[model samples]
Target: MTIRPLPDTLVNQIAAGEVVERPASVVKELVENALDAGGTRIDIDLEEGGVRLIRIRDNGGGMPGDELPLAVSRHATSKIASLDDLEGVATLGFRGEALPSIASVSRFSISSRRTDDDHGHVLEIDGGRVGDVVPTAHPEGTTVEVRDLFFNVPARRKFLRAERTELGHIEDWLRQLALARPDVELRVSHNGKVSRRWKGESDLLSGMRLHEALGEAFRDAALRVDHAAAGLRLHGWIAQPAYNRASTDQQYLFVNGRAVRDRSVAHAVRQAYADVLFHGRHPAYVLFLELDPRRVDVNVHPAKHEVRFRDVRLIHDFVYRTLHEALAGTRAGTPSGAGVMPADNGPAPSPASPGIGGMTSASGYMPQAPLGLQVAETRAGYAALYGGLPAQATHDASTVAGPPQALPDSGDATLPPLGYALAQLHGIYILAQTAEGLVVVDMHAAHERIGYEKLKCAHDGEGLRTQPLLVPSSLAVSEREADVAEREAATLAELGFEVTRSGPQSLALRSVPALLAHGDVEALLRDVLADLREHGESRRVAAARDELLATMACHGAVRANRRLTLPEMNALLREMEATERSGQCNHGRPTWARFSLPEIDRWFLRGR
Candidate 1:
């Protein structure tokens, strides 16, 4: 067979195979087109999950009669003109492959009349067979009707899922779009009944729109993150670690207003929450990254769901550091000005921020401030608790004096977030009274976080400690692995591993990090090498060190059932206030909870 040029119809059908996977994909393409056309109000009608019919009407700047035919022609778009334009393309639909692709796979009709045209015109196409453009009714916008989708391709039709499942996909994509463009009004109808509507709000995404798009739960527990530094702007809402989900379904990351799934971004987020979140749980966030268009590539894939950044490491570090600062003391039980709505439909309420050191609550709380930023030898006695020792010295018999001091309800208004500990309940919970309400703390978990943070600080202050092995274990590996071992020797040394290439495909591990002395050294080295080869850096070594420190903190923290006097209890409360991330333990379990006065009053029907 000779090299032959494919016909336009067949070529479009092939593109459709990628651009239009299901009704949802078609809906995405059409809605994006409408958005690019400056549509403020878009109405989408679907039948049988958009298989039978998908009609989208947008009050946008419609095309003239002359452009109706060009609309279905492949590679024809108003978004970009040249290679330089392609590099900085910002519109949602720029490839110009969606229109012709969908038209070739189904019976498509595009009727439109520009603001300047005298009347509307309709162009019909059956499986890429173009029809004559005829004059139609007057209209100042475009209305596209797609019927019998995938009728020409039986295989494509068979791959479609159930109506409900397909509808779910469409709804999910619409919700994502709603998040990015809160200024665009969107309405959806399925099976002839209006199912959902998102009213356009201000340019910012928050309040009712955010709650409707994500959920009320996420909105209530969200923290506003607006940080611009290092030539990038990251702004969005990040939920508290306590209010996490089982999966990353709620994490909506938008790069220049386009939703994408980039591994580097995801990994950065994961690393940011590494020390705070519980194991086996995921975070919920709606973040948007805005940067120079030239620094990122959006035309890497046909679906445009992935992107390549010019400075991936810089992006990773920025996202990680920003989120880390936001969550610094969120779990530490600090009286923060974090906005929290009512969990139920009862009524909206605000969080009572505990003012520190007699400072005004409104003007006092700073997330970036050091919680336990004292200039003490943090690690000298930090791990003593891991050995069943108290985090602080045990209170002497004279320390208790009389009974637990009563917390002030008035007069002394600058109360700490955790308040003063009144008593230890059941040798586990430290019950205290705060100016806002009551606070119950899991002593073990709280101390664990405190001790863990100190241990980490100490570990960082003093560089990694290397434990030399007497035997100097030798391991066999591939030539590539051996090359990596030799190349990354300096990086390995920084991570407290001294590795030397012994032979063509062998390495000698002379020492390892003291914290990971008992771990499987050979396996750990292999994993590190693989990480370095892929990510240009290895987190496994740091992760291993942190894991060891966590275990030490867990064992060293105050044990449940250990009786404590009033002074010891109060001392613990003060330490918690001074410690960062005291809201949860090292493993992500919440360390404390505050029950506002109204919450406690509701239990007893105070007013009613």
Candidate 2:
């Protein structure tokens, strides 16, 4: 077979295969064009789920009569003119293929009139056949009407879902766009009945719109997050750990005002919520991450619902750290809301006054040097404050020594975030009263999170203590492995691994971190070398360190069924308030829950 150029109509039809998947796809393309035209108010009318007709009207800058024909021509776009313009495309719709592609598959008509013009020009196309441009009624904007989508291609039309299903897809996409652009008003009608309308909002993330989109539950349990650093800004509402969903429908993430579903961003979010949400439950959030346009590529997919960040790890860490810090105050409420999580390139927030839990640093539980393990100074300060005793003495006095005698003032505004513990229910739940109302806490889970944070601090604060192997374990390896061992000898030392190339294809491990948990040291070393060779960096050392700390915390934490005195319970509550990440246990289960007076009153049917 000889190769030949496909016809213009065929080319557009092929492009339509990508740009127009269903009626919803047509809705997306048209709305994007409206947004690019500087549309402020858009009204959409749908008939039979947009299959019979999709009429979109936008009050934006309209086009002249001469441009009406070009609007239906391929590769005719006003958004970009040069290669540099493509590099940082600020417009929502740049690809000129949308108009021509839709025209090739359906009966299409678009009309527009400039603000100064007395009349608008309209052009129609039926299955790639262009009609004469005619005068239309006056409107200082643009309106596009598409009828019988995929009518020329019966096979494609056959693939479309039911009417309601197609309309649902359109509604879902609109909601996502509304999240990023709260300034634009939107109106929708189905079968001539006005179905949905959202009044424009000036606030970046409007609580009213968010509640309308996500629900009042998500808004009630949301935390306002605003963090900006290193050319990246992440600000939005994140639902509390206790407020979650069975599915991931509520997680809406946008990069650079473009709604996108990225694995890197999603993974970062999942990791940030790792220890807070229950297993099988997904978090509800409407997070928006704003960064330089050049740093993200939004043209990766035809639908433009996914993006590729320039630096995956950098973006990932930014999103993860931002959300992680915002939710830290929920479990144990903040005192005056002073402490905040450190931004990507900044130091952690430190406490202004000395506290009961020895958490003097405002950065909460994060160590000054997580990688170097600098615990000696923290240990010394802790030792000196509570008398020169064992490090565990500063932990929980209730576990070893009996409960205290005299109680501190529990009345008025001086109570801790978790409030004063009134009693222990079933030796598991700690009942406390806060200014808000009643608070219930799981003793084991609360202690587990507290213990976990402290262990991580002490473990990271104290640099890894190297210990020589008693047997001096020897391992066989490849020639490349031997080279990596020699080249990364310093890196290994930094991670508490003292290894030297023993031969052309073997290595000798003589020392390891004393704090490192006992495991397959050889396997760990091999994995580290492999990671170093692949990514020029390794997470094995950090993962191993965290595993060890988690284990230690699990063992040291207060176990359930252990009786506690009133003073001990209150002391634990104070510690929780001062500690970061105390809202959820090590496993992401909520440690405490607030029950307002209204809820208690409702239960008792007060004033009924």
Candidate 3:
């Protein structure tokens, strides 16, 4: 057989295979077209979970009668006309293939009337067969009807899931659109019965939309994030660390208003939460990253669900640093409105002010001596239990001591976030009182976080320690990996690695981070190289160091079943309030929980 150009219909059917995977795919394309047309309100009607019929009506700028035929033609798009236009596309639908591709696989009709037109016009297509355009009556907008999706292609039709499953996919896509475009109003009906409606919101960052989409709990736990720098802006809501999920179903990322999945940004978020999140838990977030269109390519995927960033390392670092700083305020006792934990009803207490000897006036308990003396008294006891104070403890024990002062009154406005410790519960938990109500703290968990933060500070101050290997280890890798290792040698050195390329596809690892010297050196190098090649940076070394430090802190922390006096407990509470990311322990478990007075009253029926 001789090679020949594929016929128009055949060519269209082939393209349909990529653009029309299922009914949900059809919805995505059409809805995106509506959004690009400046549609403020959209109505979606579906039957048989959009498998039998899908009609989308949008009150947007509509095309003229003459443009109807061309609108359904392949490669005929008004979104872009040249390579430069494609490079910096801002609209959602630019390929122009979505309309024709979708038309070829299903029975489709489009009716539209521009605001200035005397009448509307309609065009129809049946299984790749185009029909003549005819006059019709329509409102000042566009309405697209797609019927019997995949009817002409039995093989493709067979692959579609059950009605409920297909509808679920469509609903999920709509939810994503709703999040990205809160300004657009959307209404949906299934089999003639209304299913959902999202009213248009004037405020793009309205919490009502978040509550409607994710539920009340996430809305309440949401932390507003808005920061701009270096030609990039990231704004959205992130669930507090304590409100984590078991899966990543709630993670939503949009780049320049288009919903997409970017591994680098996702990894940055994960790293930001590494110090506070539980080992197996995932955080929930709805984030939008905005950068110059030239800096990102959205044409990478046919479905437009992925993008290629020009500077992966810059994006990663920016996201990581921004979120890292934001989460640092998760220190225990922050006001509810401050994005940490929610405060209970009543006047929000003022943040604790620095008091004598580095203690806060809000602690409400006066120690008998300087904080340093207290640590010295407990140093011998801790040494007897855990061998000796770690280097971090030794450093802190020397500097934290200051002259003691009188405690504040219980009703003072500057009450510490955790309040003054009332007593120890079973030697494991600290019971305290606040203006709001009760606060129960897991002593061991709280101390572990406190110690872990101190250890990190000490380690950072001293800089990363490198351990030289007596015999350099040789690592065989791909040529690309070797090239990346060589190019990123400076970055590697900053991460406590001393690697040099010995051959075209090999590396000589002379040293590793001192903290991870006992672990797998070659494997670690390979992982770091992989990250560098893909993300232009690597956090493997830092993650490993943090894990080791976490273990040491856990061992050094105060254990359960140990009694504590009011002053000792109060000191611990003050330290928690001052420490970063102290709301949770090193392992991500929340160190304390607040039980507001209203909730306690309901539990005991005190008001009744």
TM-scores vs. true structure, each candidate: 0.88, 0.82, 0.91
Compared with the true structure, what per-residue lDDT tens digits does model 2 show for residues 210-298?
76787777767777788899999998878877778999999898887778888767766776777677778898888889888888888
Per-model lDDT? 0.79, 0.75, 0.82
lDDT of 2 at 354: 31
State the displacement of the C-alpha of residue 438, model 2, in Å, after optimal TM-score superposition.
1.3
- What residue pairs are clashing in model 1? 331-582, 331-583, 332-582, 332-583, 335-354, 385-556, 386-556
- Candidate 1: tens digits of C-alpha lDDT, residues 1-608: 89999998999999998889999899889988998899999999999999999999998999988898998899999999999999998888898899999999999999997898888999999999999999999568899999999999998899999999999999999999999999989999999999999999885444467888877777777877879998999988888888899988999999999999988888888878888888889999999999999899999989989999988868887888898877774645554333431121111111122211121222232222212212123345534323432344353445343544565563366666666667889999999888778899998888777667766666676666788999999999999999988988999998888999999999999999876788797899899898776555667888887887788777667778876665556556665666666678989898888899999999999999
* lDDT value, residue 29 of candidate 2: 92
Report the candidate with higher TM-score, 1 versus 3: 3
Q: Best-fitting candidate, measured by TM-score?
A: 3
Please list all clashing residue pairs in model 3, or write none if there are none: 336-343, 372-401
Off by over 4 Å in 2: 204-207, 334-411, 464-517, 520-544
Distance (Å) between predicted and true CA of 21, model 2?
Answer: 1.2
lDDT by residue (442-510, candidate 3, tens digit) is 988987887677666656655667889999989899999899999999999998889999999899999
Report lDDT (Cα) of residue 444, candidate 1: 87
